[model samples]
Target: MQRTPNWSLQQLPDMDMGQFRQWQALLEERTGVCVSDQRKTFLQTSLCARMREQQMDDYQTYYDYVTQGPLGAIEWSALIERLTVRETSFMRHRASFDCVARYLHERLSQPGRQTPLQLWSVGCASGEEAYSLAIVVEQALIDTGSSKRDYGIWATDISLQALEQGRAAHYPTGRLGGLTQAERNTWLTDTPDGRHAVLPSLRERVCFSRMNILELAQAPLRDLDIIFCQNLLIYFRRWRRRDLLNLLAKRLAPGGMLVVGLGEIVDWNNPLLERVPDDRVQAYVRRDSSESLE
Candidate 1:
C-alpha cells in the first residue's frame, strides 16, 4: 500500500520571482486583486497551503493545474477563498456608520416616501457589517417614526465561504462587543453553544449572495438607496478602483448614498456623484436628475 505523504511536515518550496509573477497575473486577471512585491510571501503561503492539500510539490505544475478546464475552475474557487482577505467586525468604522445613520434619518424624514429602502453591503464578510447596517436602519426607522417602513439589505461577497457564514448569522460572543447592551438585547439571542445569533426578524431582512467584484457590470442591482463598500478597493490597481467606483455610482438611485473607505482612492471624481463634504467619513451622494440638469 502506498502511504499518503505527510504534508504537515513537508517544507513548501520557495516561490521564485517568475513563478510569483505568473500567479500574480492570474489573480489580477481573474479577480482584479493585484499582489505587490511586499505581499509575495502572503501569496506564496496562501498558494502553498492549497498545494499541500492536493499533494502537489511544484509551483509551476500547480499553476498550470489551476488554469485549465472544469476542475481548474473549481480549484480556482477554492483558492480564491484562501487568497482574499475577509477581516471584518461589527461597526468596524464608527464614523462611517454614523454617516449612514444620519443619511437614513434625513431620508426617512422626507414625507410621502412610499418605496422600501434598498441597501447593498458590498464585500460584507460574515454578515457583521450587514447586521450592523440593519441595526442602524432599524433604529433610524423607529426614531424617525417610520417603524412601519419596509427595507431590505443585499449582502454580497466573492467568497461563498464568507457568504455561508453571513447566512448562518451566528457569531462568537467576543465579536459582539461593539453592540451596546440595549442593541444586543434587541437584536441578538444567546445560543446554547455560547455564540450569539441574530434575531429572526433582523435575519429575515438580509439576503446573502456570492458576487465577484470584477463582474460588476453583469450585476442586476440598480437604483440602490445606499451602498456600503468599505475596506475592499485597496486590493485592486488604482485605475481598477476608479472603474469599480464608477460602476457603483451608476447603480445608485438619484439622491442615494455611497460610502467607501477613507483615503482608498484620491482624485476620483464622478460627474453624477458629489462628495458629502464631511471629513469624518468618505461618502458621496448621487446628484438628483434635476440638479444634474441645472
Candidate 2:
C-alpha cells in the first residue's frame, strides 16, 4: 500500500491507473454505474472527500476499510452517497409527468378500476420527482373528477443520505421553480425560515426507500401503473441499460408506463411494450392482450 503525507481536501493526490480501474470496477459491480476514464478526477475527488472525513490518507487503505467487513458496508453507504450525483428539481421533466397525468386522466375516467394507482420513482434524488409526480397525479384526478382516487409513490434512490433528505420533504424557495404559484399554495407551506415544506398530506402519500437500480430483480413492489426512471441510464453501460429496462418492464402492470430520458437509449425494442405517441414524452406503455397500437 502506498502511503502519503498529510494532504488537504483541495490537494488530493492523483489516482494511478490501477487504482482508477479498481474503483471503476467496484462502482459498476455494486451500483452498475460505469465510471469512464474521463471521470477519473471526479472519482478521485469523491473518494478524497470521504477519506478526509475518516482521516484516511492512502487510497488502498481507504479501499480496504470500505470493503473489509460489516463496518465496511456502513462506509460503503457513506461513500456511495458522495459518488452518486443528486442534482434534481421539482417537475424537472415536465413532459414525462404530463404524459403520466394524461394517461391517469384517461384511466381514472374509466369505470371498474378498484385498486389505488401505484407509482414508483427510480433514482428519485431528493424527492423532487416523486413529490412532483404526486402533485401531477393529484391534479389529474381532480381535473378528471376522480379526486378521491387513491394513489401513492415509492421513491427509491441508492443514496441513503438523499433518501433521508427526501423523507424530510423540505425545499428552499427557488427550488420549486417549475411549480406555479397556485400549486405551491396548494401543496407547500412556507416555513418560518422561508423554506418550503411539502404539506403533510402530500408527504404521507410518498414512501422513500434506499434502492440500487442494479438490484432490480430483487426489488419488491411489482405491477406498478407508472415507473419514472429518468436521467439514470447514462451512468450505466449500453448492455446494462437494456437489461435494466427489461427488468423494469417486468414490474409494470398491464397498460403501465415506463418513462426514461430522451436519447438515453437507442434502437431498444421490447415486443411487450409500445412507444408512447407523444413526441414530447420519452415513454412506453405495456401492451395488454388484445390491445393493438393505433
Candidate 3:
C-alpha cells in the first residue's frame, strides 16, 4: 500500500493480486489467525524480505512458493516468525503476579503433593513474563523448616529467534526502569550504569522454547497446573478462536488454571473454564480445578 521501493527482507512490496488473501487463508488454516485488513499492509511490509530472498516478484507467488514448494516449510516458519508480534517488557501488567502469588499461597496452605509447581507462560515475549513469574515464585517460597519443593517455569513463544533472546536473559538498562534499586539488587546484577543482568540462578529457573498454538492438539501439556496465554488471541479469527479454546481446554489439567491477559474475552463462556477471583485479579479456572487462593 505504501508503494515504497526500498524495503527490508521481511517487507514485501508490489503485492501480487490475491496474495494477501492467500497468505491470510494460509495463516488462518495453519495458525487459526486472521490478519485484519488494517494490518494487511503491515504484513506486506514485514514480508518483503522473504520475497526478495526467494526471488519472487509478488505475494501470490511467494505464498504459493512458501506453502507448497520444497522450501515451503522454511519459508513458512519465517513467515510466522515475522508476522506474529512479540513485544514485551518486564512486569507487564503487574496485577498478574499478585494473582499468581495469591493463588499459590492459598493452594499451598492446604494438603497437597510436594512436587515442583508447574507454570507455563505461553506467548511469553523475551522471557520477561516467565521471569516475572519467577519473582513471584521466589517470594512465595515457604520459610518452613524443611520445605524445598521445586518451581518449574516454561516460557514458550512462536518465534525461535525471540526465544534465543529470552534464553540469554540479557536486557538493556533503560528497559529495566520498573525495578526499584533494592529490587534490582536482589533480582539482578547491577552494572556500572543502570543496566543489570538477571541473576544466573533466576535465569536457570526458566525454560524458553518455541511452540505453536496451532499444534496444541498434538502437543502434550498433561501435567501443567497454570497457563498464561496472554494477549495472544487478538491475532486469530472466530472459528479459529473456538478451535483454540477447545484445545486449550483439553490441554489443561483437571484442576489447573488458565490466566489470559486482562480483559481478553474471546471464549470465556467455554464450558471447560470457570471465572474465578484471586483477590481482585480475575482469571479463568478449569471447571474441575480445585486450586484456589481462599
Q: Report, for every candidate in turn, its global Cα lDDT versus the true structure.
A: 0.90, 0.88, 0.71
Per-residue C-alpha lDDT of model 2 across residues 1-294, encoded as one tens digit per residue:
344456753578668899999989999999999989898989998998888788777888898899999999999988998999668888887777788888988878888888899999999989989999999988988898774759999999998888988999999976796888899999999999889999888899999998889888899778899999999999999999999998888888888899998889989988778999887878998988613322
Worst 10 residues of 2 by lDDT: 1-10
Q: Per-residue lDDT of 1-294 in model 3, one digit per residue for the tens?
A: 123344544334555547777777777887766887777777776777556565565666666677776678887887777777667777777677677667677656657567677888888877878887887777777533228747788888888877887887777865564455665678888667655678887888899878887887776665667887777876776566667666676666666677777655543566777777554454766766433221
Q: Lowest summed-lDDT stretch of 10 residues in model 3? A: 1-10
Candidates sorted on lDDT, descending:
1, 2, 3
- Per-candidate TM-score against the hidden true structure: 0.94, 0.94, 0.84
Candidate 1 yields a Cα-based lDDT of: 0.90
Clashes (backbone N, CA, C under 3 Å), per candidate, total: 0, 0, 11
Tens-place lDDT per residue, model 1, 39-127, is 99899889878887887878888888889999989999999999995778888888999999999999999989989999999999788
Which segments of model 3 are wrong by more than 4 Å?
1-12, 53-55, 142-146, 177-181, 191-195, 278-281, 287-294
All-Cα superposition RMSD per candidate: 2.5, 2.9, 4.6
